[model samples]
Target: MSEMIDENAGGRVVVVGAGPTGLLLAGDLAEAGVPVTLVERRHAGRSNLSRALVVHATTLEAFDARGIADDLIAKGAPVQALRLFDTAVVDVSELPTPYPYLLVVPQYETEAVLQARLDRLGVVTRHETEVVGLRQDADGVALTVRDADGTREERAAYVVGTDGHDSSIRRLLGVEFPGHTVVASVMLVDAVLADPPSLRIATNTDGDKFAFVAPFKDGYHRIIAWDQSHPKAESEPVDLDEVRAVLHATLGTDFGMGEPRWSSRFHSDERQAEHYRAGRVFLAGDAAHTHSPAGGQGMNTGLLDAANLSWKLAAVLRGRAGDALLDTYESERYPVGTAVIKGSGRLLRAAQIKATPARKLRNLAMHFALQRPLVNRRIGFALSGLWVRYAAPAGAHELTGHRAGDVPLTGSPSRLFEALRGGGFVLLAPTELHEPAAEAGVRTAVPADGGPVRLIRPDGYIAWAADTPGAEEVALAIRASGA
Candidate 1:
């Protein structure tokens, strides 16, 4: 095998799997002036089939930081609330953010947007390429890749696997993916429905069966249904008849479904890597974790994983941060992945209740709990990903490690997320502190009247904040964040 060495290999990143996670992460690195190479096993063509259909509010906010949220929002339908069973509803209209609803776009559409960004940034993706082997040393990583031409070895300072559940990189690293199957023989289909449900998202269960239906921008509906009484093997073929039967049984009508474009039968497993990082190699998206599709958190969680890791990788490679900054990627994201796994599993188990009395009780409890405003808002925030926060140190500010929402600012950028477009820390402080903040290697903005001084990370989280503006403290915080 021939060895291909990049002149800038010491500062380069090799990303495996050109899915949304890898695409977004590569784009972020390229935008930040870090060299990135994206590799994928699939041929270079956009496919219509997709398993993920929901984009949560927090993910949209992340896209907004990259200046691509508007483009993606234009390609999907937004649902203000999600209906679970006949009685419970989780409304997201009152969330304190620009995007207060869930965008129901196909996974392919999201991938297309990210791919466009990567193309604009001149980041070429190597398709029809697969990773056959991996090795890492103290200095960098070496990967064995196979393409149509031949097999070769490529080197990079770091390697990230955004590959799906059966990640070759994870296997090569011998990382343990521990979890069990949540449900078997789940049916997924994309079809044109003659009559669609009035609700933007329709989901319910009738004890033995459960189904979920959401609209696509192209007049098709993505349906996921399961029948506990008639479990089928993953190899069994799923046709329109079987899908129609389950939808009819669970949703009370198939909505005259016909002309299926895609269908499949698969099992849902709740698995997470024992560790996200192994020396110079890391895992993100489905490579790091996989969970039931109850709350549609799989892809959203993966995209967020890429967002969390991209900036850190860029910072370290660019010499703006030390290697320890890379460790935060796993510490900050592992707990979120674990919580999503458990949360989605709970939703799946709740929907799978098979007894009449138990189902009634489950629905009643959900309905009663959702009626309270506090509980309703909390559920909305959790599902939309706004409730996520990293662990903060004892003496840190209250806002530290929390997401910095799109608050108005008295400056040229005029918003917190807009300032993040430059891919650096942003300090929202008093006018008198602007020069000092700028000297600390961060963009400075004047906050609206009476707002506290804050240092926002490139990914839109509050790295540090203070009610009382102190130049020393501000500079120290920015330095501490490895800016």
Candidate 2:
């Protein structure tokens, strides 16, 4: 760790990790012309561990709004729908969105896409660098960092901690990470198999164990199992032999377990930081919440956290909004993080319970509930995060609590997101008034295919939609989005 102090260093926003959350936030900040310096303890590139696999539809839309979904598709596989099974398989189609199922992409590939975007935005991540300490007064944050050779100090307008569960920033601030362990040790298996299983892989369960397998490369699979009361072996390489045994016992079939690529064991834990922001220092992703991977919410939630916070940070850094805008980072995300932790706990218990007669009866009842189209759609919405609608602040509007899906035009679909690419408020109007709307700092388009007027926010949600409304309605939406 370097120990040289340059406390007067300034202008850049110091980001404390280069994972997906940090990289995505840095990209947005950099694109907004906020000088950003991202620091990471590890060398640049994705970790070998196969952690998160499912990218929910909300995240897909977030990526698509940035024009990166095509690149993501090139890097991973796309499933049309997720198949749930208990006594039988239930297919839940007719989900409200265009993406009805989760996109199965490795976390590394997801990072790769974001990294490329970061490169395009001219943001450089300082690898092998660690944030040792930080202090904030009324003006800005003063941060101390150490690299391989020596220490250096830099001052920044704000700091964001995207570091993982044991975050140094969170520790430095003395924020209590409150929660309990899920009481299960899980083995993760990463391997390239000669042949792959045809099972639909989100999460699978049997007696006393939970199994999850996701495809990575053409022949690679990431497998994980939760063992409630298994004995630990002392071998250093994570006891690949034990991992194979657990997979074989639970799945009741051969994994085609080829030479292992990477393997590790981790205990399930559900924890969240007491506060996401303390003056100039803020937290996002796992730095704010750590939970079981039951719903594949860990990385997804973190990515969304980055998305939600970046716009606010950029707004304040650019002096367009006051620091009070940044305060909403915790107000909007803390409850969502708490809900995710609770939701994952329920799903973990539901999936891994020992099947007695009573358990079987409960499973049957759940299956019956899932059989209804409406119930299945609701479950899909929950799993995909489309059901989450943030509360609008006072005097917002009547169109406050909607997810802003696509609306079709005369011959094609008009995506509400196209208008929100630059992360600002937009007001759509009748074709006749497109020029008038442009004077209000709202980008005007004719919707070449002839659709109704719409309004989109920088976060890619529809702020307002109307049937060829006049300029007065468009002005109201602009005010609603705080333009």
Candidate 3:
């Protein structure tokens, strides 16, 4: 990483927060030979307090494009279906992607994979360097960073804030984080179980208490419990006794919860930043949106945000895309963020229904809805992020803006994703078609279908397609991608 540092510091981009989102974005930029500096406030170490635990299909596709998804799948537990209330389940086995289920790995493991990718690219992360404030004009962004050494200025062509919920960069940019608390004083505990539940997931409620238990990849369990009757502040201490009480009250047993390693009290909120971009600065991950942990979508959403933005940033920086390409990041991600917040909020509200009759009605309705394979499949698609697709422009091809499934490429016998090894677009065209500009960051491969031509973005979305694609279609897609 030291040797790979950019010679022209002023021309490089700086990413705040060395979390999963920042690391992935930095790796994407660096892999494309774009100068990037990743800054973090904490020393690098895997956290025992694993927050996000489920890696969905969309995220797996993103990782697979980087050639690390299979390795990550090897290191985690796979849950084929997510058990909702006793009557319903989100069967991910019906998903359209190769990864038809969720990988139950801790957040730390995700971070480690990304960190390794960054290291391989020689993109060193400057830890303990926190962005205190920032100011930007026509030229670049000047950050007020503080570390052990003291405060100093660091400049970059553009800055991205992937910092968590309470992001310093978001505040410095004067963005409004608008939303309300979904679950107050929710207790979280990571513990070993001498007598574990027969099921990998257990969720139930009794009277005013609610409890959920899901096993980690390591066989340990993470328990989340909340009690409407027992009001407490988020800072209040959480203990094994309190956990046992809540679990017994809600789930009829504690599953022999003992030997706690990490415990805390937190509140889930349904909120999103009013703006993801402000001039030259931008936000991704928790810095942009957050919501109830009911659907386990925060991390997945953030990672997708990074994947969408990184390519545009790289394209803009490399002079392959225009400045307008950056605008699409917010335009695309903001709606996805809004959808996540709404979906998670719905789940939280259903779980928090205090009245017994209301809970019964909700359960019955959900069960009836999930009774059909089509409905269940739709639910799986949404939770697993496979449901996400961009809006198609008028008079565009049918597949335009649709999520590009991994299709077998011509000649090489590899898939379209394999051609993305260099972090650029992959244009599939017949030998007769001509697209000279496609050579730069665009891999010209034979179409899997042996059909018409297609332009796939780095993040695996079809931008343009035609029966007889030429330089005009390729050029239009590149310009649309801001490449």
TM-score of each: 0.96, 0.88, 0.94
Model 1 lDDT tens row, 254-355: 998987788888888999999999999999999999999988999999999998998898778766689998999999999999999999988888887878
The order by descending lDDT is: 1, 3, 2
State model 2's lDDT. 0.72
Measured with C-alpha atoms, the lDDT of residue 137 in candidate 2 is: 91
Better of 2 and 3 by lDDT: 3
Can you write out model 3's per-residue Cα lDDT over 1-483, one digit (the tens) per residue?
111334375558889998889989999888877788899898766666577878888999999999888778877888786557655666678678888987878788898898888877788888878888799988899999898899998889999999999999999999999998877888888888877766667777664777888778787888888887876887789867878998887777888888778888888888899999999999999999999887789899999999999888877776666788889899999999999999988777778787878888877887888878999988888888888889877998888888888888767847877777657777778755445544443567877678667778889998887776667666766666554
- How many residue pairs clash (N, CA or C atoms closer than 3 angstroms) in each of the candidate models, in the order given? 0, 3, 3
Superposition TM-score, candidate 3 onto the true structure: 0.94
Question: Best-fitting candidate, measured by TM-score?
Answer: 1
> Considering summed lDDT, which 10 consecutive residues are worst modelled in model 3?
1-10
CA displacement after TM-score superposition, residue 407 of candidate 1 (Å): 1.4
Clash pairs for candidate 2: 2-150, 2-151, 3-151
TM-score ranking, best first:
1, 3, 2
- Over 4 Å off in model 1, which ranges? 1-9
